[model samples]
Target: MNRFATLFSASALSTIAFGADSYAAMPHPGTEPEQQLETTITRLSPSAYNVVLIESLRDDHSEPPFANVTPQSHEARLVQASVIANPALSRKLQAQNVELDNIVGAETAADGSVTFYLR
Candidate 1:
């Protein structure tokens, strides 16, 4: 019975996977957008991370490249809020023309700067 259940589950999963991809309109043969990346960075003190990072996906993702950037006082609260109480940063983000509720990715530097990815 255990073996039967395992086989049944595998069969069901394979069916779902095959069905999900069969009707999809994929981009051109070699033009998948998976490799393309867009990233942004913000540095701060006691940086409160509002995003979750997947350790397994690090290889596919690009690291933040905000080195040599001048940290501004105004942008301090942008990436410095604790995960729980960051009302100011939230408000500022909402006011932006392109609101940023959460980041696509983020990296911390040895010098205590943070680079937040946008894509």
Candidate 2:
């Protein structure tokens, strides 16, 4: 009886571990955008980021080249709440006739929120 119980427990443990690994292997639908953005942002210096704002888009998704960037590798979160929260940045960009496409800065948290940066 003890041998049977041990076998059952071991099987249960193996099943749980396998299940956790499978879940981890699957791509997270929510984290995708932030992960991509983080890859792009890390490729730039502060000056480069500013210049990027003035850059044009070939299509709605023709963002800067960040082909091999890794998210969560940066020193900080890539979006700044203050920038998104500020009326001034919006106004400045608007004055330049650049409609705020997104705000992929380096200081925002990822909580599965639809941030302006991820737009």
Candidate 3:
């Protein structure tokens, strides 16, 4: 009966080691920024600030380019272009052309900033 005892111990240990606690410790499936972007796109108004896109793309960049202003119509043009080009944002931004090679982000001009990804 030692074999049965060993099997039982092994099974118990395995269950505890690879159980609910481990799963709970894991991050939620899609709470990441990328996924959130998709959802937020549907809600973006025509005038979202481009700075938001810059923040999204340059997430790992040491210092993002523009962080000063709010969203505007002029900036919105560039933001739309960036969204159209970015693969990550392509599907959601497909209302316009999708440029797979394009880098998505924001830019600044005299008046304000525009974000391609909806705010």
Candidate 4:
């Protein structure tokens, strides 16, 4: 009868230990999630901005660069690149009196660079 009581007490203690461990391991409901920031640089023209290959930039986790970017979020990066590249293109276009529409396509490079095609 004493042995049976000892065995039952051990089993009960182990069950309580496991329950406490599981509760501790569970994630808390109200924690703030982490946000990933964009680190990609775009080369742009009147056409498309060259984007870094998603496969090359992604880690083993397969998270893509700029994966969560919205169109509005990308405007600042585009405007900055255009400001830099447009001066030269604008000069040539002005000389030729040509007006181009907007960016269209990108040519991918194996070196993780993109050449934006202009119209």
> In candidate 4, what are the lDDT values of residues 1-119, reduced to their tens digit?
99999999999999999999999977677532111001222222333234243335557777554444432444334533443455654454445443323322233345544443333
Looking at candidate 1, the ten consecutive residues that score lowest on lDDT are 34-43
Candidate 4: segments with Cα more than 4 A from true spot: 32-119
Candidate 1 displacement at residue 57 in angstroms: 18
Ranking by lDDT: 3, 2, 4, 1
Q: What is the C-alpha lDDT of each candidate?
A: 0.42, 0.45, 0.48, 0.44
- TM-score, ranked from best to worst: 3, 2, 4, 1
By lDDT, is 2 or 4 better? 2
| Number of the top lDDT candidate | 3
Q: Model 1 over residues 85-116: C-alpha lDDT tens digits?
A: 44544454455432353343345545544445
Candidates' RMSD to native = 14.3, 10.6, 11.2, 13.7
Clash pairs of candidate 3?
Answer: 49-71, 49-114, 49-115, 50-114, 50-115
Per-residue lDDT value at 51 in model 1: 37
Q: Between candidates 2 and 4, name the one with more favorable TM-score.
A: 2
Candidate 3 per-residue C-alpha lDDT over 4-113 given as tens digits, one digit per residue, 9 for 90 to 100: 99999999999998897899877777343433443454344435434234456466857554444334544444444445544444564344443323334343333433
Candidate 2 off by > 4 Å: 21-27, 30-33, 44-77, 80-119
**Structural similarity to truth (TM-score) of each candidate:** 0.26, 0.30, 0.31, 0.28
User: For candidate 4, what is the lDDT?
Assistant: 0.44
For model 4 the TM-score comes to: 0.28
Q: How accurate is candidate 3 locally (lDDT)?
A: 0.48
